[model samples]
Target: MLLEAHSLSFSYGNTPALSDLTVSLPNGATGLLGPNGAGKTTFVRIIMGLLRIPKGKLRVHGREVATESKALKAVIGLVPEGEILVPDITAVQYTAYAGRISGLSSTEAMDRAHMVLHYVGLGGDRYRKIDGYSKGMRQRLKLAQALVHDPKLLILDEPTDGMDPKARDEMLDLLKELGNDHGKDLLLCTHLLDDVRRVCRRVLVLSQGRKMGLVDIEMQGKDTDLYAVTMRGPIPPFIDFLESHGFKVDVDTDGEGQIALSRGAADQFIQHAVSQSVQIRRLVPLRESLEEVFTRLVSKDT
Candidate 1:
C-alpha cells in the first residue's frame, strides 16, 4: 500500500502514452517492464511528479500527489536512465552534495555519502573521479545519490543499462540488497526480464501506451521456458529418440543441442528420453528469453 495509481492515463497530441493504467505497489520491488516506447518512462514521470497526469489518481503514502508534491518528493528517490553525476567530481563529493540538497547537514551528508556508497559496493572507490569510473561504478554512484536522502521509495529506470554482463549482474544484486536489506520500496522500470526475475517479485507490463498486462513475476516465470540442453552422460541418443516421437529435435554429436517447443513438450521430452535408458546430465529447457516474451506480448496486444 505504498503507492497507488488508479485509471492513470496520459497522451501527447493524438498519441497516447498511457491508457487507463492502474496498479498498487507494495513495499518490495515492483517491476514496470516493457520494451522501448511502451510508456514505461511516462509511467515513472507521472509517479515522480515530473509530468502531470491530467486524468486519474496518483498517490504516495496516502497523500495526494497534486496537493503534496513537495512532501511526496521528500519521500521518493529517483535514479533516471541517464548519468546524474558531475563528471569531474569524485563519488564522495557528489554524493555528499546530493545528501545536503536532500536536507542534511554538512557532517551528516558526508557520513551518509560514505554509507550509501559502501552499501552500493563502492567502498574503495568512493573518492574516485566519476569521469574515469567504469559503467558499473557510475551506476553505483547514481544509486548512492538516490539513497543519501533516505527516501521511502526508490524508482530506477534501466539502472544497469550500459553495463557489461558482469557489471549488469553486480548492479542487479546491489538493487536486490537495497530493497530487501534496507527496507526500501522499489519501482524498477526495465525491459530486462532477468532483472525482473532476479530482483522484483511483482510486475506490471505496458505496451503501446496501453496497460497490457499486470501479474506477479513468479507467475510469468513459472515453467514457461524451454532450454537448449546438453549432457555429459549417455546423452547421445536423446535427440534422435525425441524426434521419433514427433518432438521436433535438433542434434549435436557432442551431446549438446537444442529442443525448442512448448513447456509441456520440454518436460515430456525430458521424461520420455530418461525413461528410454538415456542418461542426461542436463535437461535444460530453452527458456524463452525476456526480449522474446516482450516481443510476443506487444505483437499480441496490437
Candidate 2:
C-alpha cells in the first residue's frame, strides 16, 4: 500500500477535521477529491509528517508514520498549494536547497536540481531569480523542487491552480508522463474534476472529513446493462413498446431520450424502432462523466 490509515481521526481544538477515516491506497496515480473543509489538506499534512498522528494508526510506504517520520520524509515529496519559495534565490539554488533538505549530498543535489529543472521545462529560466518569474513558471519551479529528491510518492496540492489554459495542459501532460513513463506514484489533491479525470486512474473522495467514496476512473460508468438511446418519430409508442417488453427506460422530461437495455437488447430495440417507424438516431453505452460522479457522491453525503 502507498498509504494506509486505520481509524484515523484528527481535530483542531473543538472542531473535528478527520473522523475515523480508514483507507488503503495502492501504488499508482490517485486523485484526492473533496469540497472545502473536507480534511484533504489535513490528510496531506499528516503524510508529510508536519502534523502528529493524534488518534489512530497511519502508515506510509508500510512504515509507521508516528515513529518513522524522519526517514519517511526522504521518500515523499510535496508540492504545496501556497507559495513557499524564497524570492531572492535563483531557481537552481531553490531546487538544490530542496534536494539537500531531502538528505542528498551537495554535489548530487546540484546535479539532480539541474536535471529536474530541465525536465520540468525550466532550464532556460533556472539561473533567473524566482521573483521575476511568472505564475506558470513559479508553478513549474515548485514541481521541480518536488522532483529534486526523486521521491517515490509525490503529493501535489493544486499544481495547476493559477495557470492559464496552455500552461495547465502542459502541467497535466507532465503529470501523465511522470505516472505512466517515469514510474512515479502520485497523489493529486485538487478540486478540478477534469484534472482527476485526465491524469488519475483512481479517486478517493472525502466529505466533511470522512471517506465518501473510492472509485476507479476506468470502471466508473461502463455499465454494460445500461445504454443511452435516442430516436426520432413517435417517442410515446417506442417507450410503450420498450416498457411492455420489460426494458427499463428512463426518459427525460423533454420526452426525446431514453436510457435502457443490455447489449443483447440492442438488435431487438432497433428492430422494434423500425417496426414502429421510429428512426434510431443514436444508441450508445452511457459513460458517466467525472463531474456527475463527484456531484452524486458529495450530494449523498449531504
Candidate 3:
C-alpha cells in the first residue's frame, strides 16, 4: 500500500472534518473523490504532514505519518489546489526553487527544472513569466514544480479545475502517461466523476467527513449479476420468461435484452433459453458509469 489510514479522524475545533476513516491506496492512480467540505483536502494535508494528526494512524510508504513526516516529504510531491506561484519568476526559476527547497543542490535543481518543464510540455515557454501564462499553462507549471523533486508519489488537487474540454483531455492524457509509463504513483483529488473515471484506476469516495467506501473504478458496480443480452431470434418470450422467474428484465430494440438477477439464476436463464429455442448471441454484463457509482455511494451514505 502506498498510503494506509486506519480509523483516521480530525476536527476543526467543534466541527468534525474526518471521522473514523480507514482506507488503503495502492501503487497507481487513485482518486480522492468528494464534494467541497467532504474532508478531501484535510486528508491530504494530514498525509503531507502539514496538519497535525491528533488521532488514528496513517502510513505513507510504510512510514508512520506523524513520526516520520520528514522522510515522507522527501518522497511525496504535492500540487496544491490554489495559486502558489510567484508572478515574476519564469517557469525554470520557480521550478528550480522548488527543487532546492526539497533539499536538492542548486546545480541539480536547475538541471531537473529544465527536464521537468520539458516533460510537462512547457519547454517552448519555459522562459515566460508566471503572471503572463494562461490557466492551462499555470496548471502545467504547478505539475512541473511538483515533478522537479522527482518524488515517488504525486498528489494533485483538482488538476483540471478551470479548463476547456481540449485542455482537460490533454491533462488527463498526460497524467495517465505519467502514472502508467513513467512509473509514478498519483493521487488525484477531485469531485469531478468524469475525471476520476478517465484517469484513476482506484477511487476512495468521501462524503460529509466520512469515507463512503473505496472501489476499483474499473470494477465498480459490477458485483451484481445484471447482463445486457443481444440475440438474433425472437426476444419477447425470453424477456417474459425471465420476469416470470423472478428476474428483472428490460428489452430494447433489435433483440436486445437486459436481465438483472442473482448469479445463481444464470444457470436457470441458460436452461430456459434452450427450452424456449432462443439463440443467445451475446451476453455482457453492464458496467455502471463513474457518475452512477458516485451518486449511489453519496446517496447511500446520506
Candidate 4:
C-alpha cells in the first residue's frame, strides 16, 4: 500500500470531520469520491500533515503520518483545493520557487520548473504573469508546482473545479498523462463521478463524513469478460429463460431481437442459448460504466 489509514478519525472542536475511516491507496490512480462536506478535503489535509490527527493511524510510503510527517511530505505532492500562488509571479519563477522550497538545489529547481511547465501545456505562456492565465491554466500551474518537487504521489483536490468544458477535458488529459506516461501515482479527490470513472483505477466513496463503499475498478473480470449479446430469435422467451435461471438479463434494440447480458460466463450463456436452439448474431455486455457504480454507492449511502 502506498497510502494507508487505519481507523483514522478527526474533529473540528466537537464536530467530527472524519469518523473511524480506514482505507489504503495503491500505486496507480485512486479516487476519493463524495459530495461536498464529505470529508475529502479533511482527509487530504491529514495525510499532508497540515491538519493534526487527534486519533487513529495514518501512513504514507510506510511512514507514520504524525511521527514521520517530514518523510511523508517529501515524497507526496499536493495540489491544494484552494489557490495558493502569487498572481504576479510567472509560471517558471513560481514553479522554481516551489522546488527550492521543497529543498531542491537551485540548478535542479530551474530544470524541473521548465520540464513541468511544458508538461502542463504552458510553453511560451510559461513566461506570462499567472494573473493573465485562464482558470484551467491556473489549475495546471498548481499541478505543475506540486510536481516541481518530483514527489512520487500526487494528491489533487477538484483539479477541474471552475473550469469550462474544454479546460476540464484538457485537465483530464493532463491527469491521464501524469498517471500513464509519467507513472506518477494519483489520489484524485473530487465529487465528479465522471472524472473518477475515466481517470481512476480504484475508488473509495465517502458520504457525510463516513465511508460508504470501496471498489476495485475491474476493467475486465479475471476469468470472464462481460459482453452484450444481441440476437434475432425469440426475444421474450430467451430473456425469460435467462432470468429464470438466476441470470440478470437486460433488453435492448440495435435492429436485433433483444439484448442479453452475460458475465465471465460467456461460454455458459452461449451454450444455454444453443441448447435453446436460438440463432445468435451479436452478444455484447456494455462494460459497466463508472456512473453506474457511483449512482449505486451514493444511493445506498442515503
lDDT score of model 4? 0.82
What would the per-residue lDDT of candidate 3 be over residues 96-167, giving only the tens digit for each residue?
999999989999999999999998889999988888989888898999998899898999999998878998
The CA lDDT of each predicted structure is 0.80, 0.90, 0.87, 0.82
Give the lDDT ranking, best first.
2, 3, 4, 1
The model with the greater TM-score, 1 or 4, is 4
Please provide, for model 1 over 26-52, each residue's C-alpha lDDT reduced to its tens digit, 9 standing for 90 to 100.
668888887688899988888778888
- Using TM-score as the measure, the top candidate is 3
Candidate 4: minimum summed lDDT over ten consecutive residues — where? Answer: 253-262
Root-mean-square deviation (CA) per prediction: 5.9, 2.8, 2.3, 3.3
How high is each candidate's TM-score? 0.74, 0.88, 0.91, 0.85
Ordered from best to worst TM-score, the candidate numbers read 3, 2, 4, 1
Which should have the higher lDDT, number 2 or number 3? 2
Model 2 segments beyond 4 Å from truth? 231-241, 251-256, 262-281
Looking at model 4, the pairs that clash are: 224-264, 227-284, 227-285, 228-283, 228-284, 228-285, 229-283, 229-284, 230-282
What digit string (tens of lDDT, one per residue) describes model 2 on residues 145-195?
A: 999999999899999999999999999999999999988899999999899
Q: What TM-score should be assigned to candidate 3?
A: 0.91
Clashes of 3: 0
